[model samples]
Target: MGKSRVHWLRFLRLTSSFRRCPLSKRSLIIASVCVFHLLLVVSHFGYSQHQLERGIDEDKYRNARGFYNLDISDALSDSDLQTGASFVVPTRSNVVYITLKSKRLKPAHIRGTIRPKLRRKVRRKETNSAFTQYKLVTLERDAGQNKRNFASKTSLGETRDVYYKSLDITYISPTDTRIDSHISSIRIYSQRAPPWLSPKDVEVMRFLADANVLRIKEVSHGDSPTLLVFEGKTSVPKKNRKHTVCGGQCGVINIPVDTSEVFAFHLDRVLGLNRTLPAVSRKFSFLHDGQPCPVVSWDASLYPEGLAAGLSTVRLTWGEYQNSLKQRCWHKNISPKPDSGCFTVHHYEWSKLALFDFLLQIHNRLDHSCCGFRPRQEDVCVELGHHAQCGDPNHIQLTNIIHRDHNPRHLVFTNNKGFFDRNEDNLDFRLLEGIKELPEQAVSVLKSKRLREKLLQSLFLDQTYWESQGGRQGIDKLIDVIERRAMVLLTYINAHGIKVITMHV
Candidate 1:
């Protein structure tokens, strides 16, 4: 109270002094003092407001950071639970504390939560939308209709299994019942094994299909397909093994776009020709961006003269080839004279090759000059000017006429690049120009109307090829082409009066 009284007396004295001065000067001083006091009061209020705002902003920032820390803590807790480890998070002021806890994860829970999601994603990637939609519709239909008819029809479990099998999304182990019991090494991916495949063929196919590829290199010569060396045990006996690379197991990898080799292999088998190497469609992740490629069993015997010499090809001009076919060299175990201009290949081999090439339109061996058919500009014969050389029928040389070194009498069909795109009007008659006979077995197959069924059954063995060619519908179209060609061939045989002889050799 005394302090307040003293301040009031001092203020009164100051006012009295101001009153003693001139009236105008005193009023000016009083107005200046009032303005200065008002400015001071305004500055004090603004400072207080700024401090309050700063406190609120700091609180808000702290809350945001607290939420961020909580999220990190949750992630850490998940990691800890997965790894069965503990973590310590430092405490901070104005931040909520998150407790770290560890829990054991059950195998069933993990699989149930993660496997289905992963499987679904993979299924989507592997299949198109149309296929998935079809499967879904099938499942819905089966469930709706089969529920009441289960007693008379197939069981519900079997119906569900069929749909699941069609998806082909389930994982199959290497050792499964799909593999043939006698030939354990070979895996049969389809529903049934192809009866045409022998045990030795199955073994070689298994090596080509599933063996680990060690290295890939060109066949040591220009204008040759790539060869893939596989690291595994081959089915060949050690005494008969002649190949030095890849421990005698190797495969010729055809390009992704060149699927004719696979078709030719199946055709050869179905016709009972048994000349083409075992070829199966497989995918190499390292090559062609994982597209399906035709892998053919490689026979080192084809390169007995070494890889630099290329295939054991029979060097014969067109006239010479036709002349040798007419001479019927080495028929019935009779050898040819030195001046006969006949090669080591037997007579029946040409007949078989002619019939085979005519059906498949493989001109690389018999008609390298595109003389038999109207070739497009993109064809190798036209692009490389081979078609122009057809003028000199006596000089034009045959190419890709390969045979094994040890067995020159029997031809081994390599580079079986058949064409299904050729129309009936443009059939290659030149291939069968000099042929006088066709294999009885092969002609019988053509005569029978069961060609489609046999081809389907044989081709279904290679699941990769079956699916790669757009499944059953696409495969049926290819068969339809062959069937048309077969009809044409049969008509030609009847018109030419070619003998359908049994070629046991």
Candidate 2:
């Protein structure tokens, strides 16, 4: 009471002073300004103290409010995996198809589907409207196997088929507008890959193709034999979700079933060379307009050639093509050093490529008429260029180097359609002889009897994919020839003695 009296006395004295001085316009204005400033200062202090006591950070409050307002339901609609959870009538459907996705939050009512007789307590508050406000009560399970059929983060990492019907969902809560039921949604992280292709390159390609995500930036001018080298980016889905596949620009080669590209990729993986671009077996399905179409696997560009008019495309071999490269030597054109004619360091990679071709009995390495592009040496498209030049494996063009931009000294074997000849004994090592160097691992793998056995077993496991494509006989022959070639390679390496060179240049 004494403090209040003192404050009142001070306020009266200030008012009396203002009254005495502020009769004039300038004095009245000065007094008003002083009072306004004092009020602002007092208001700011009160606001700060209130905020501190309440633990209310303005920035954090705004951020949290915005987060709660985010509509996850709309995102689920745009995703590849469909949403299954929803509010329905008491008598819902018996079977519900749910996508096996990751870290899905399901409602407790879902449990009632399995155990209909069980009752659980639900705290509900009545609102002014028909709806009821309720909080979510959840029992989380570990990531591994559980009897509850609930999966936690990282527990259900793999894709599995879940079978349930609509009737399986029990109504744990009474149907009332007041009751705020939990909204459950599934988010599929990784999906099952195709059985026929490798996991990375081919699997992503297939996904892009199926999702209509591929946009062909250009159909290269040098592409041949109906093979289209697609330079495109994987379109981001409208769902705003990340994918397990490639999203940025990458190269994809479309080739026929008879081509050795797929086999070469498989062999590359088996040998651990990883020098080849990954390949997946894809049949023609869509048109340029992204419409469904049934068509043969052949390059549309070949229709302009005179030879294509009468030739049976299936019978056309890479060995049959002859071009200007045959008349001249590429060594004179693409010498690595300033003026040396000896094999360049790239010859070491050529040696590996040569041995790979020899193992498959492929001789199109130097044949332009084969399924290779004869681009003007300057206008070569890396993605669409020829795999082999037309002169000698020892004299290779710089552009023919695969992954040239990334690894200049290394070779990338592509367009491998002309392989697996009937003659298993005719193994050519001309290219391998140029470098006179072989990967020690390649030599060891070739020499290991146990490795050969494992390779045969793996090949047999992959036979299913080939057999589905009606290439069982070809796969069997390929396996047998590979075994024979391994023996031949072992003998050749042993007789000549391989030298391993480890120079970057």
Q: Best TM-score goes to which candidate?
A: 1
Q: Report, for every candidate in turn, its global Cα lDDT versus the true structure.
A: 0.69, 0.39
Candidate 1 vs. true structure, TM-score: 0.62
User: Model 1 off-target regions past 4 Å?
Assistant: 1-192, 222-228, 233-244
Which 10 consecutive positions of candidate 1 have the poorest summed lDDT?
155-164
**TM-score of model number 2:** 0.40
Tell me how far the alpha carbon of residue 437 in candidate 2 is from the true structure, in angstroms, after superposition.
2.1
- C-alpha displacement of 457 in model 1, angstroms? 0.5
lDDT of 2 by residue, 94-132 (tens): 222211122224435543446457668554433311211
Worst 10 residues of 2 by lDDT: 131-140
Q: Model 1 over residues 1-505: C-alpha lDDT tens digits? A: 9999999999999989877899899889889999999999999999999999999998786655331221232133454446533321212233432222222343244434555344442333455344444433332332214334333543211211112234333333332222333232233432223445555776677667666544443222323432434344445565664434434577766667668898898899878889999998876543444568788886777778655466788899999998898889999979999999999999999998998898888898889889878899878778668889877878999888888888989999887888888899999999999888899999998897767877776676566788899867778889899999999989988998999999998
Candidate 2's C-alpha runs over 4 A off are: 1-218, 222-257, 286-338, 341-347, 366-399, 450-465, 468-474, 500-505
Estimate the overall C-alpha local distance difference test score of candidate 2: 0.39
The number of the candidate with the highest lDDT is 1
Q: What is the Å distance of residue 194 in model 2 from its true position?
A: 15
